[model samples]
Every structure is written in structure tokens, then in C-alpha cells.
Target: MIITTSTAGRCPTCGAATVSVDDAEPWCAGCEWNLDAYDRQRRAPEFGWAWVDRWSHRLGYRLTRRQFTHLAGRPLGTGGRSAAAMVTAGVSVLLIGAVLALAVTGVWLIVAFPFPNVAVLLGVALLGLAVALRPRFGRLDPELEVLSADRAPELFALVDEVAAAIGTPRPQVIGVNGDLNAYATAVGLRRRRVLCLGLPWWGALSPPERVALLGHELGHFGNGDPRRMVLTQPAFTMLGSAADLVRPVDTVAGGGIIEMIGEALGKAFQWMLSRLLFGVHLVLVAVALRDSQRAEYLADEMSARVAGIDAATSLLDTALGHESVALAVRREMRAGHGPGRWRSAVAESRAAAGGRLSLLRQLSVREESSLFSSHPPSGLRRRMLAERPRHDPLVVLTEERAARIDAELAKEYEQIRRAVAWSG
Candidate 1:
């Protein structure tokens, strides 16, 4: 489906060996020839702000080189998500200081309970501080329809199998929503791992491909993505808060020169704070980007290992196929079909595509390359997968078993279909 290290082709530019990933195109690892040809935006000759763009482009260019040089070729086996010391230390100071302050406030409020005025004010302050600095134990999104084992035993069993194969803990909650994607996350104070499947996507995938999806998603927790870590994730959230707090503010001046000067000074101070925040953000992000990309590669490997190379690559093809597949979803929304015929709809759309799918996929690949994209370009990912050794699927979903899952989610899909139809 993706990345292969076969040297059957030759690179015209360097006379170096060319590798074909997914058989779409042959590219050279030495020069990264056609792989970057898709990044049209990066190759643009002009920009609205030329000077700023030139500098930014240089930075991006450096980052892209750093990415492939550090990340390419071999399997990235659970490259753990890493955080910058600056971010880690800085977030720790803020949260720990806030916690300590809250503790002190609590003790003060308790001791001063004998005094009416002070106690009342301190008590109010305690509640406010506690709320403000509270641990961000993320909450489950209410939009999801929670599915217990009793409701969807076959589906839950599949999850258990995938988790076991990936060597990760089974998600405590499995839910579904009417969306085009799936995700794995930890939610609530106890940090219950949750898998929220998007019905449209779930319905599109083959049984083995679904296992690949599970492998990649569940791999997030095992790969040590700092964003998924309950302890460090809150700290990352606090950084966003700090950035917003220091964000630049526009100042309006009254008629007087003195007032104008005062406004200018205020604006300057705000700008300085904003710039400092930007610097912190830039540094922290640069540090985190490497780890994040590494984690993605590792997750893909887990997917390949758990569900076989072909299935994993086909699953990744969903990235390429999403736009084409959206037509099916839209058609379903328009038709208001109960129980949502995803497999048939998806097949119909792909069949209509004829020869255009590859071109569309290439265009999509070009459009997705960015300095800050969370995942590596799907094309590059495919190539990486091709280069790595292939693996046989560890978990397989038989047709009859898949049918059982479809039956279990039938009512939910029907309701979702009606809702989508009405909303449209």
C-alpha cells in the first residue's frame, strides 16, 4: 500500500536508486525528488509578504530537512513523545505555584473562619483559585454515543484484540459519533482511555483495515505522545492559557498627545509580552515537533505490525481517499438512508473515480505538507511504510463477526442518519 525500498527503478537526477511507494511514483531517497513535488505552496515563487515569507521559508526549509534526515528510512519503534525542558519547567512552576497558593489560601480561609468579613472573602477567593488552576482532567465529549460491552460485544471484543496485539491497555470506553474520523484519547479525572469511532469511516474500512486504524490510534497512548499523557497534557494546555493572557491588545487613544503617548506605551508593552510568548511557543513547538512526528511514524509501524503492511497502507489510503469518500457521505446525507450504507456508497464513489484517484491523492498530498502539520504527509508516510519490513496481521475480523458489529450499531446509525438528514 505504501513505502517500499525496492531498487528496481533509477533516479534520473542522481543516478541513485529509486524506491516506489504504493507504486504511485518512484522517488529518490538521496534527493527526495518527487516526494516534495506535491508541496506546491512551499514551492511558490511569490508571497504577499515577501521578506517575512523569505525568512519563514528558510526556517521551514531547515525544519523539513531536519525532519527527513532524522526520521526517514527505518521503523520508528515507539519513539516516545518528548517535551522541551523549558515548557516542562515553565508549566511546572506555574501550576505548582498556583497549587501551593491554593493550598495556602485554603489554610488561611479555615484559620480565619472565626472572622466573618475575611473568612467570606478568602473562601470566595479559594473557590475561584481552585476552579482556575484545577487539573485539566479532560471530559468525554457529550456528542459521542457511548457503547458498553453489553450493547456492542463484538465491537468491544475487537477493541480488546487490537489492544492486546498492540500491547496497550484496552480503552475503558468505546463510543461512536457521526463524523468522518476516529480518535483515541484519555478523559475524566481518572483518565479513562476512550476510543471514539466515526461511523462513516468505520463503515468504509475493511475488517483488517479497521484493525489497522485501531493499532494506529491505540498506539498514541503507548508511543508516549506528550499530548496524550494525562500528567503533561495539562501543562501544555496552561501554555495556551499563558499565550492568550499575554496576547497583543489594541489600545485606543483619546485626543490628547499625553493620552496618545500612554496608548503607544501600553501597546508597546503588550507587543513585547506577545513577542515573548511567541518565542516560548516557537521553542517549545520546535522541541515537541520532532517527537510528535517520530510518534506518528511509530504509530504507523504499530498499525502495520498489528494489521499487516497491506491493510495498514490501505488504511492510510483513507487519508488520500477521504475527499473522494466524502461524496458518498454527502450522498447518504442527502438520501437520508437509515443504517447508513457506507460500504456500498464508498464503493460507488471510488468506482466513479475511474483513473482520477491517483491524481487527486497526489494533489492532496501536495496541499497537506506544512511546517506545523501534526502528521507527516500521507505520501511520505506511505513511502516510509514501504521501506520498513512487511508484517502479517495479528488480528483479523471475519465477515460474520463484522456483520455482528454492524447489527449492534444499527439503531445508532439509523438515528445518526436521520439527524444528519434533518441538519442538512
Candidate 2:
């Protein structure tokens, strides 16, 4: 259960210490923050779209997980297994393209020309096959601002400390961005390890929580998840690329009777190809998500070992409570006034919301593990940590060092925010 402070007593908008509670709705004497009124707006009572969207995602995720578990036994694989899966997927797409080419050639000969026009039929067939088989390699750019050791020695030093504590190699590269998330990913065909830290998310955490979060991301590298994902990512992209090459609705119609007949045939062929590709895409995603969920569990355990269970649990709480309080913080930040501290702002928003986190945690427990999600539910992670033996904190943060680190990165955070917005 989420232990919450008393609500109907404080103002969310203006950071007012107290509000008058009249008829169950608290009104801020300091500002226009009315708890009941803001809650209604935040929840979006109109049309119930939020609940619908959430339920739809949950349903799809549950089905995907079920299908994946039935097809592939638990603990999907190491990097090699993922690579083999991608190779098989690539070959399957190529084979489908070749079959489609032959089918197209036969149809063109029967419908367009009275006799066999060998050269033209071959040209059409080859062109269609080439189009279907073409690969769209993902973009190489990291996009976010890359931070080198020279530029941020203190941050790198902290990362090194965390890595040493966890017995993992330090990330080769570091990038900073605006997201409320931090992750370790392998980039490019070379599989370069990149540690991406989101300043917004880091700024929201306490010093101990920061250690837990950073250790968790670094753990992904040692856990073998990043390498596996890098290998399989291109294959998932290929499925979408193949589907796009023969999308049924993208076909154009011409005026002549023969042209119309050809268009209809093309549409039918495309429709069949799309359905086949979509089914393959679904299966591939399910397998990928299964691996992702396991990777997260392993990574979380590493964090628990490196940063202590209390810190890990606090990190999880911050992550779960983030979405609930994000809007209120955004509104406050947008008005030129400032809460100045993300953690305090979140706490105030939670108080205003009246322990809605208890409800969110309950929902998370009730919802089945999703194949569409990269991480397991927060409640599940918390429970797993609770069952594990406690360890001493690996890297304790002195107040002086923590404050100095924050001081150094303060300007960099602003720069990152501007860059993200400008890039968009």
C-alpha cells in the first residue's frame, strides 16, 4: 500500500501549505488550485477515452505474452539465440518475396498479354521482387547530445564507481537528453554500448535513488540484454518495411479495363502478403517482448544488489508515481512560476490527488504481464526485490559530492532541453 499524506489540506498549484476543505473539495487561498476541479480535468471525464486506450493496450499485451510463451519456452536466449532468430526472419522475408515474384509473373502473362511476353513479364517480376526485398537500415545518428568523459569528468567518475560496484564494464559512450527515462543500448552494427541518461529523470531522484537508477541501466550491459536487442531490432524493422512494399490500399487504379483488372489483382495479392507479414510481425514482437521482460528483471536485481533494496524500491516508486504527477508539474512549470524541485512537486501533486497511487499499484498488480512492454509491472518488481536478500549500499553519495555534481550539470540540462525542442 502507498502511504500517503493527508489530502484536502494543501494547494497543488501554488505550493500553499494549507487549503480550506469545504464540501470535500479543497480550495487554495493562495492560488486557484482546487483539488476536485483539477482532478476532474486531469482525469478527462469526457468520453472515457483514457480507460479505453489503457484497456486496449493491456488486452493486446496480454494476448501477445500468452502466444509467445506457448510458442517459445521461457528465458528466450542469449545474444547468439537472438541473432539466429533474426537470420531466420530475414531469410523468410526473402523467400516470400521470391514466391510473390513468380506469382506476379504468372498473373501478368495471363491477364495483360494474349501470348507470353517473356521480357516484359520478367522485368515486372524482378522489379516487384527487388522492391519487396529491399532493406531499410535504421538511421545511425544518436540524435541526442553525446557527452564525452572530457566534457563531464565528474559524471563519468560517478558512472565508473557504479560500474565497479556492479562488476560491469563502463559504457563506451554517454548521451544526455530530455526524456524522463535512462537506458543502456547497443548502437550500430558494431554494437557500441551507449549509456543514455535523461537529465529530467535524474533531476527527479534523490541521491540514493540516482545511484539505483544509474546502476540499473548499467546492469543491462552486463546482463547481455542490450546485445541481444541490437541484433533483433533490424529484423523487426524489416517486417514493417516488407509490409509497406506491398500495402494493398497504396495501389493505384488506371482507366482501361485491363489496367483495372490488373489493379484488382495487385490489391488482392498485396492484401494476402500484408496479412502474412502482420502475423509474422506479431509473433516476432511477442518473442522480443518476452526477452525484454526477463532482461528487466535481471537488471532490477543488479540494481538491488548494487544500491540496496530500499533505494531500488524508491526508484520504482518514483517511476510509477511520475506519470500521475507529470501533468500538474508541467502546468506549474509552464506558468513561469517554479516548484524548483521535481521531487517536492510530485509529492505535492500526489497529496492533491488523494492517494490515487494506491489505486494505480492495485491496477498494476491486477494487469497481466504484457508482451508489448519492455519492463514488467512496478508492483511485480517491488515484490521481487522484497523477496530478495538485502545488500549494503554500494556507492554512498556524500551531500557535498551530490550537490557538486548537480551544480555542474545544471546548465547542461537546460542545453539538452533546448536541443530536444529545437530538434523536434
Top of the candidates by TM-score:
1
lDDT of 2 by residue, 71-96 (tens): 23233223343443445455556655
What's the TM-score of each model vs. the native?
0.76, 0.68
Error at 12, model 2, angstroms: 39
**Candidate 1's residue-wise lDDT over 1-424, tens digit each?**
3445556677778888766544545556666566544332434533347665455545554565466567677446634333443365456567657766876787678677775677767776775656565657688999989999999999998888888998988888889998989998887767789899998788777777888899999898788665576555545555445556656676554588888887788777877887776566555555555556667778898999998999888777765778667677767656865333666777676677665544444433444554455676676677678787765789988878888898999987777677777876
Best by lDDT: 1
Per-candidate local distance difference test: 0.70, 0.63
Candidate 2, residue 242: the lDDT equals 67
